[model samples]
Target chain A: MTLTTLPPPHHEPVAPHDLRARVTDVLLRFIDDQDQILRDVDPELSTMTTALREFVLSSGKRLRSTFCYWGWRGAGGAPDDEGILVAASALELLQGCALIHDDVMDSSDTRRGLPTMHRRFARWHRLGDLHGSPEEFGTSVAILLGDLCLSWCAQMFDGCGLSEAAISRAKPAFHQMHTELMAGQYLDLLGPARGGGSSERARLIIDYKTARYTVGRPLELGALLADGGPELRARYAAYARPLGEAFQLRDDVLGVFGDTERTGKPAGDDLRAGKHTVMMDLTRSRATAAQRAVLDALFGNPDLDRDGIGKIQDIIRETGALASVNALIEEHRTAALSHLTDSLLETETQATLTELAITVTNRDY
Target chain B: MTLTTLPPPHHEPVAPHDLRARVTDVLLRFIDDQDQILRDVDPELSTMTTALREFVLSSGKRLRSTFCYWGWRGAGGAPDDEGILVAASALELLQGCALIHDDVMDSSDTRRGLPTMHRRFARWHRLGDLHGSPEEFGTSVAILLGDLCLSWCAQMFDGCGLSEAAISRAKPAFHQMHTELMAGQYLDLLGPARGGGSSERARLIIDYKTARYTVGRPLELGALLADGGPELRARYAAYARPLGEAFQLRDDVLGVFGDTERTGKPAGDDLRAGKHTVMMDLTRSRATAAQRAVLDALFGNPDLDRDGIGKIQDIIRETGALASVNALIEEHRTAALSHLTDSLLETETQATLTELAITVTNRDY
Candidate 1:
């Protein structure tokens, strides 16, 4: 079943880079506007806008923006409409909110190759000799900052230059996306403890947390803005879901196998953390009795060292877990791409989306 | 300057209580709707909805909604428009977002006299024997829940059954409230660390964090929905800001002097937290060098004992800080009530607003 549903990432980088650059500019302008509004309240409050600007503009793949843009393009949104670009940029704020909270949830110290917001705030507490536990203070500041991002996401979306009709069309999808994303985050927290680890359960999480959020809804948002009807939305979902899971699976694979320098964290970090990923469940289902014992001993061990990591890596490879995951990736990729066949989307936008699928699934860094 | 601008809460509870009950019912229905939506996504995610319902419905004064409902009434809003009630209920969700984030920021273990959301989530981790740090897990869950509330606040406001014109009128105020509240939170955080602790700085924090957020904008939102003109909005703000600050000042007083059973926390909780407010700044300014030395040693001490709290309390009283704060509250009350004198508000709604001012400032719990 995995064989037919997934496919490998296309190897080379896809270059539809201008739109991404444009989306960044849109975000910067919005932040600058906010800077003025906040400054009027008090000069000190502008620090938040500055932090928000740094968080948003410093780095991002702008994948959702591109997906949203292309979705609009596919639905005959005017390529020259700056309004769509402004509207599409709102997705980044939404993503930023998610990442800020996700890092806090995971107790992650870094993101985008920089200290995560909470870590930075924690450091401030120590350096400033502030009155509170640095960790608690840091967590608090990050939580507030994340909240600011969530609030600003809605502000940006509502204030972005979309026509009333376009906004009306997009509103339900946007609202549903947020509700789903939070629900998905809750479900993810439930996963490791609930301990199903079955591929079916994994797929369900992926659908809510990644696939629909990262791709399907965004694409539908674009289509909705341009008045794309039911059939078009259905097609977008068909193409989005498998590809999104493929993207996540690739991240999981790279977490174990990719070079530490490239992935920005240690190889097998996920193994030490024992992240409730489906790939591992598949491995557990197939592992020999001795391998199962090794897995049980090493997985999620905080003190698991390089040697333990290497051993687990070897078991994963030896057990054909790597091969099967690759098989699953290919199956999803094929399933996603198959929807593009005979699609009514504008040819250029369709091609860009196809390329995005490759870049999303295959990126090593 | 502070003494001339603030006022005391009237001692009796004014009971123009229909709007509050109506608002609660509206919140319950909204939460129920969200419950259904999340359950549709997955059974487990519905737990978030349950938690949210508990948080919102448990114990809030419904101050913002009351202010809003009366603002609408004052602006000739039909006392019967259920839509306005729904729109006003959105404030409680917005308040929910603020309280959850604020509790996390303060690292306070309780809210409305119960374990904070993070505390509750953390307890779940310990009880369920989940695999990570319970505190971290709890904080993360709380942060996500806050984001969910913030999102639903907007969604509810937008989806509330208002005509397009009313929504358009209300949107900017609603949007501004969120932006300013976050900015105020940021300013409040900066106060202790940056340490001017002057009355001016504290007042600025109050204006943004509590004054406008707690009262001003909610009224404006109601007025806007009812097409209250600029004159009416200006009058509303003039009435709101001083009354809002009086409410905050009264809270500061209660935090120090009210019964723990009534206040829902220990006496001097704000002093223990070293919360920067105009009332405290006055104490600092008037304190003798010996008293200053005592304060420097004890304020914000996380391990502050009951003896230390008593010492601080004695100083606050002796320095005449408590007297000046009450004096300021009365001044502001007079200023706020002065607006009602010539106001064109419906007599019934005017009486309600006047009574609300007394209840909000005077509440023991």
Candidate 2:
């Protein structure tokens, strides 16, 4: 053996683009395997499998998986571990399940500047000139597809080629992640049913539905996989929780005010859908009687025109709800980023995490 | 040490009622644990948890769990094992998920003589005079509850306290069961979307949607848990596959002709839903031109009245389709039962399985 070349000191910090590409590659191979399973059962499932591949591989920031990757790295895991990549990729499949079902419940027509899952299938029904109501067909297909994603998530995790003990160690967090997310979804349904929920209720929803599910659990999952000690696990949570809150707050702002082209969702869409976001709750709490009246008339009106939306927008800003939300977001971002500055984690990991926090919380979409 | 009558010489052969009671006991305990998890998160979730408890505990024949138990017994697993009971009971939760989603997709009004999951929630919304469309609220709740059941199924299975190796061995079958069932559902959806399907298509649907999932996989799971050899596993599949098909055929017969009081569904419910059942396909294929005219007019009519149903029923009999289906059921039942006799299984196990096969296939409901 010649000493012609020496191994690099450590794997270079995986670039965001490279991380995304690797995740995508794993996801594609996984889906292709699943597609074969479906095909073996029946060729008629080709359409559904094709649609799933597209829905999963198509778009959105791979934030959850990236956070998981970094969490593992921060806990002293090898950057080049293939098993960690496989485990991290499972989150995207779970997210796919959530989004597909979410769109069905919301009756959303579009996502990512294209037809949502149900809408796409509904269009397929119309084009095929198939029997029965196209809308119902779409909804049914979406439900089954969502169920498939959920199943595939478990299958992928178990088949990730990790040691059985390691998989067992991570199982509790995985189970908790699901239960919490579903509970959050259930609470979200309650808001619309019970009518104009309190800001506290909105915050609780944020904790379970968006913050923990979108960020905290993914990080914990990664940390656990690396056999990180309690101290490291606590650090991950402290960094993740506030950052998650900030991320959702940003989403709330984007839902109301961001450009549709950038966000891939209509401006004031949350208001139109009557979503009980914290910002809306704050606006309700702070608005003048006259402003409240305008909100009652214009907010949540499904057919609300530009004038109505503009009026509600004015009320949100005039009552200082928008400013307050922005301030809260900044506070969360600061609290999250402060943990990284004097951390025990490696310098590269800290720098990467910091950049991620800024990019997520400060995004326009 | 007191021998205590030597454990009753092979466990006294658990009676059907006792087996059901035991399964119910385990399920109640599991749900209680899950209920605490929900309550710890939010008190508002109490209603949802309560609903889940009632929906799960109130009804069902517990056939899947029983079959799983017998599968274990036939494979020489310990009759007194609590872990097997836990693993077996997981099937009930899985069934709950499937039925809840099935009801939603079918827009079903009732199940087991009570309002369906969605309808029950919708009615609650109406009674509370809550905001938004009650129908939409109901659908949303059903979807979430269904997802919860799916998650809980996995959770329960993982926590069953079986050896890791045993659980790992059964994992592939458990995963396959879900994927196959979902694909079956997808195929069922395609039937309606593509218009009236052929008899072969209906048989394929039965094989996947009903036969393999409801029988073959559960038996395989139990057998695998016992470390049953390939010969024993093959025998279980042979017994289960045909029995499952017969069970579904019986269900098809009951859907049209069984008493509403016994079946817990409106008479001719499947016809109203336009389900493309094997019997229906047979009827269509065999009907004369004049008979076909009546079949086309009366079959799959949503508002099908007693007289219209009678006309279709008469046509089915006149075409010899009902007789053909009945003969097919007998053929499958005999084929399934033959695997039990002169088998490697214990005599007691053979007898109990024989009883189950007859009861499932011969039931009115």
Candidate 3:
């Protein structure tokens, strides 16, 4: 079945509000504690660390951590405060580190309604009259700071005090998450360099880079930590796969059409960067000669200005790319919901997860 | 006792020849196996992966892995075929990954008598006629490839089937090693940016970054995994700490005065790059006004010619920096050997490790 056709499960609606709120609260506290540890390490380093923590902890869905928490809960594990929170926090820290490094790699200049970490570091370099060129100093700081976060993430996991058996069982999944993410990143880097590959190849890259790392593996990791058996692991995959796809599909749409004010990025930034998104692949495959000319002229041009971005957006819309992407998002969201029906979770837990799936796909920014 | 005055141990010599040969064989075989897995995943991606594996596995002292193996053996652990080798190999892989990324970050052009990974990728980009600027493409490829190596390192460790008890015991040391390495890296980066901190601060960075991560932690990790108690762990530190300092001191000397033909890197590259070494701290502190002027003119100029590098080297030597650094290296090496006397290890194992320490510090390259 496609993602757009699943029926909603029957359950009282009160459970999700409480669970999501609890998860959000725990996440905030986790970030604060980690920030304190970072500060204690080196006061001078704290400014960048605090900024990075704030950027990541700023308002967002926190969906991955929630999924991990619920996955643990669904596997019949008790909510031991330290274990669950540490596990979830570790995931968040990993994500934070990834996003900061990804931004610098992508040359993104803004995030979450503020200057991106690299850009801020550049500003600080100028103000402080640091020894190196401002840009080099900025990039260096970002790299080191990201490395710090990555190291801290591992430390948190090691110190989490989880049962040895549980940690060992979950360890492979964690390693896979990192390896797969890097593989996905490599594919993404290679995609544009190689020009165009098969539609299937492009889709595979998207699935690996975003879908699998963002949702599938996280859910699996949580379940594994909770000692969930293979059946439960299999059951979670059904929900995770479609949810992941829908999530990426929505991101692609936002890349093309979302407002900068709401998204906290330049409009059509992805187009300017020549990201090899699924939407771009579909448009390239199906566009007319005139549309192709538009792409050829503007795609990957470093000098593409505001007017150029506008024209590219117009072409995307006129070619019906936006509608098709929206349709895919809906399709995957429905498919993800359908998977929940077959899952052997508590009714209340299943309902909360289902609602989460809907909110995730429908997110505006 | 101070690190410079310890007495050497009197022990029967144990042949490390067998252990070294066996460990090297296992490491190469495992690397080849991992390469096969990469090829299976996607033959197209194997080009970069193959080059990376070959480049890293080519030739090195394998000092870290050797320490790990010896630590395990010294702790009375039996030499298992796959277990110790796998764990040691994982550490080696991690070291390789760090080196690859660190080389790029430092903008070095060569390693081990070959083009650095970034330069290699740049050449590939030119040959392949990839889309963007070849330099940018090369940088992107190296970055992603380094990330892949890091991920693979973690994966190798995850697959290592150490008993939960052993891993749990060893895990803290593992995490601290990473943390200290990164912290040391941060200090190194900051040293140049801040135009050289106090001499003591510079020494601390070298100790933490090079000495601890390279030697001390590797030995401790292996010992911990073998279920060594606190007394045993303390004994490794007694040997490892001074040896690590000597190792860094030797590296500092090599950075300034090593032969380019043997080192692969250009002689005095560190001086030309204005690396904030402890030697630099000493030189700057002791230089006459004319010498200080010369240093200020050439330091970090990025346009320093061969003559300029030679002049800087002369200044360092004339200022007594070279002699001081040499004396420090000898002092630390002597201290390290002295500590071997205190280790509660088998006579043969103590002799082997002591010999290994001498080999590490006295290497010409």
Ranking according to lDDT, highest score first = 2, 1, 3
Tens-place lDDT per residue, model 2, B1-365, is: 11111122232232478888898888888888878988987888877778888987776688778878888888899998999899999888888888999999889899988999999999999999998999999999999899888887888888788898988999989999989899889898899789877778888888888778877888888888989889888888898888888989889988887779878989987887777888888888888999988877778788999998888888877888888888888899999999988859888789888877777777652
Which 10 consecutive residues of model 3 chain B have the lowest summed lDDT?
Answer: B1-10
Question: So what's the TM-score on candidate 2?
Answer: 0.94
Report the TM-score for the A-chain of model 3.
0.87
Estimate TM-scores for all models: 0.95, 0.94, 0.90
What are the per-model numbers of colliding residue pairs? 20, 0, 4
DockQ of each: 0.65, 0.70, 0.52
- Residue A45 lDDT (model 2): 87
Q: Which predicted model would earn the best lDDT? A: 2
lDDT of 3 by residue, A1-365 (tens): 21223344334332245555655565556556655754565555556556655665574656666777778878877865568657766776667667777777777787877777778888887897778777766766676666656656666665666777787788878876776676677677777777776767767766777667877877787899889999888888887887788888877777666667757778767877787777787788778999899899997777788899878877777777767887888898888888788548877568767877776676552
Model 3 residue A205 CA deviation in Å = 1.4
The whole-model lDDT of each prediction reads: 0.81, 0.84, 0.72
The DockQ value obtained for model 3 is 0.52
RMSD of each: 3.2, 7.6, 4.5
